[model samples]
Target chain A: MEGNLNALTVVFTEFYYWITVVVMFLIHVGFCMYEVGVSRRRNHMHTLMKNTMVIPLVTVTFYLFGWWIYFGFQGGPGITGGIGDAPFAEPWSALMATHLSGPSPDLGVSGDEAALWSRLNGVFWAAFLLFSWTTASIVSGAVIERIRSGAFWMLAVVIGSFAWIIDAAWGWSSQGWMVKLLGYHDAYASGVVHGIAGGFALGVLIVLGPRLGKFRADGTPRDIPPHNRWLVTIGLFLIYTGFWGFYAACNIPIISPEGIAGQITGETWTATNIYLAPTTLSAITFNFIMSLSGGMMAAYVVSKGDAFWTYSGGLAGIISASAGNDLYHPIQALIIAAVVVVVIYKLHYWVERRFKIDDAVGAVAVHGYAGSLGVIIAGFMLWGQPSSPYEGFATINPLGNFLGAVIMFGLLGFLPGYICARILNAFGILRIPRKVELEGLDFEGDETYNASVAEVIAAEKAMV
Target chain B: MSTNGLTSWAVDLKDVGAIYPFQGTETVLVIILLVFWIGWHVLQTRAETREFEHDLAADKSGDEQRKAIDRY
Candidate 1:
């Protein structure tokens, strides 16, 4: 703690992110509810457990190495510069553990770095960790009712703690190569979080195959209505609410001119997007509501008033516009959202029927397709814009953004997902056995439940 | 040449304001958004009416209605 003003700023920043982490927790809660609601009664327990377990598994692994990857790989090792130094993020760093406001003997962290990290490290890590869990949970929803928990958990770690973090290093970070070279501008992580997760889901689905009975004899897709429409609606609403926190968390709540250390020449304190480019809460708020409204309206018309599609369309709308929401005119966001909803809704069914790949929810369309489209659109909408405040960065262009979208959805998102799923499948652990799947993944739990009920009934009758 | 008229963020933050793209089109954008907001309700009401009509026709026998009530 130096000056009183400086001290207050640090404390405020810390508390700001802490609150965002809390709000973002609702995103997971929403995902769990949404997945459980969509699954049949026989699959409820398994679905809930599958999504819920991503939290602990991804949390532990993220703490172990995920944070390090963000700072360590910012260079693309050579694209922007050499491998950046990020000792504090390393697992063995003393700063990684609880330490007082002083230098450490465990690692070579100086007093200043240690002081800053001592207060900020845990909260920052947590904010990003929530993102990690979200990425993994996105995949979780698409594979519900059929994927084994153990197998899914492994996939969760790959996306949550490894794959997504690597993309964050290359795309989302301020000095990330994509930001430097491609002018990739995903202010709310349309590509970084949703795009990658969506691609990862598609990768897994390609190999995991459709859930039994998802297709008819003519190879046509069937409508698998959610077991509980009320739960699904409520869950989607909660997700919408939690997304406010997600948006806030993507920003530097406050930063001074000196903090940015780039071309941004100013004494004014302000909020910056992930790439250290300026934006406002007011602008993003306008775009968020407008895009959401646009999405819901378009979805209603396109789906002919289907409840599930309407809600999912709203989410898709927000996601489709999220890449440029930081800078988009509110109306531009709305129209873009409307356009993407129609495209994604059509694509969702086309992909389902054409490939017979079952996505339990329209995750691939909502996250993957919308996310990719948002990124490409941002290239044109924000064309000639600086991706980062730093010098030598490429201006935002359609080609750059299109390439970034492909890398996010195809390279980082899908490739690893397919490879890992293939490995899991070879060992006969990817999908559950057909008999158990048909009976439900909760069959074992059901057996125990029945046994307990029979015993309780028998005991009560005897007493009577 | 940038979308918001600033090619770089090198300027002082104190001077910087309203970074959203298409800076002077707020009025037009507002009009468009207003139309969308109003149009949504119009479309939604019509869709809801259609849905109700379909529901009435399909469940004319009242068997499905009874089942729904019973399930509840």
Candidate 2:
């Protein structure tokens, strides 16, 4: 009901986020396809279902508590402040539902707050929820065959609804403690989503162990080619498309200096990263494409033109440069991505051989290692840049970003993931039984379908 | 009265807010949803355990397993 400018801004912002949410859904679709494609034919249904179910499971739990965690724990809940306020994010908040800007008795907010949140909250929550699903799905691929579906779902909830959101709160949010104190600056969620999920998957893989026959008599890891390579190819392509949406979602889209209310001066409107520092859609697009190209080229050479690693390398490359993509020159992004891909590709095999981590889909290397390195790289590249528009906050630095990466990959990502998996493992529910793993995860379904086919065939033959 | 306190659309849109029904019962609904979610996990885990048990008890002949492997 305000002037046209305010109306257009609010509506445009709302619609912008809504479109991102729609596009981001392809990430899960891609995840489901990729996980299924990589798994053996015997494990197809189980792998697909395991990844597919993350959507509903994470969606509901994110609604229940994950959204609250993002808004409520931005201060680290203790480091710089106590649990911060985010009443609108609470599951029980009236603002969480359909509203049209006017205040109600049950709104628990002023008219202005209600107006702002009524249009924006659901879409914002949904965008974050997609990130949450991506986090869980990253883990889903790494531990496909042997992870008990129930146990994995529980772990998914832990990481998707709890662990990653907390990392996002401390590092990804504009006023997060990490930004304020550690000078953390991930323009996109190179670490907040990918790093945490990758580390989380690593922790789970450590306990779950590799699928049966994933290792040989000499203890060297087996190649385990995908049952269907086409699925993997298309899946990665879809993920790349969805990533465009993910990048857009990370920005504020449009905001004026007054809207940001920070050191950013002049009447010019601009898009901002999650930290509320200025960037542009054009800048990210340039960096995204260049870094992706760099990663694919490096990976093709490093992995000797392996289709799987090449695609994954492209993803890792984008993730590697994503931390500073907002401000990075396209060439810098490409070089960083290329360099990071080579390191991560070598490290992937090194860890697989030395530690015997059987990452079925190379998720740990692509997301976790690359994301952690990306953050640290950004600190050096964007050295001394303001982490926020707000006065008196820490500026981006190597040490701060390195610590932020550790916090993302180790403290928030790996720790919670390991602890949850350990608890589930202790209960004798983490891994499927040896016999079941050998028999294939889809034994029951396969048996039923086989019997149905046989019976129908016999009946038709008799009729003939 | 309507649950969201809107009896008609005759009023100004700017003066309206939450349009969902049972507005004040959000807390109660949330508690129920949480219970349902947790309960689903419990039921699912138990069922999965039973399924594994059934599979284990059915056969160790290795013939079917071999066929399944051959199918792969």
Q: Which candidate has the top score in TM-score? A: 1
Q: Where is model 1 more than 4 Å wrong at Cα?
A: B59-61, B65-72
| lDDT of model 2, residue A410 | 92
Give the TM-scores of the predictions, in the order they appear. 0.96, 0.86
lDDT of each residue in A275-348, candidate 2, tens digit only: 87767898899889988987987787677567889899999999999998987766667778988999999999
Docking class for model 2 is: incorrect
Model 2 lDDT tens row, B1-72: 333353322333334444333456657655654664465457556666877898888768978888889999
| Docking category of candidate 1 | medium
Each candidate's DockQ: 0.76, 0.01
Question: For residue A305, what is the lDDT in candidate 2?
Answer: 61
Looking at model 1 chain A, report the run of 10 residues with the lowest lDDT sum.
A101-110
TM-score of chain B of each: 0.88, 0.91
Root-mean-square deviation of each candidate, in angstroms? 1.6, 17.0
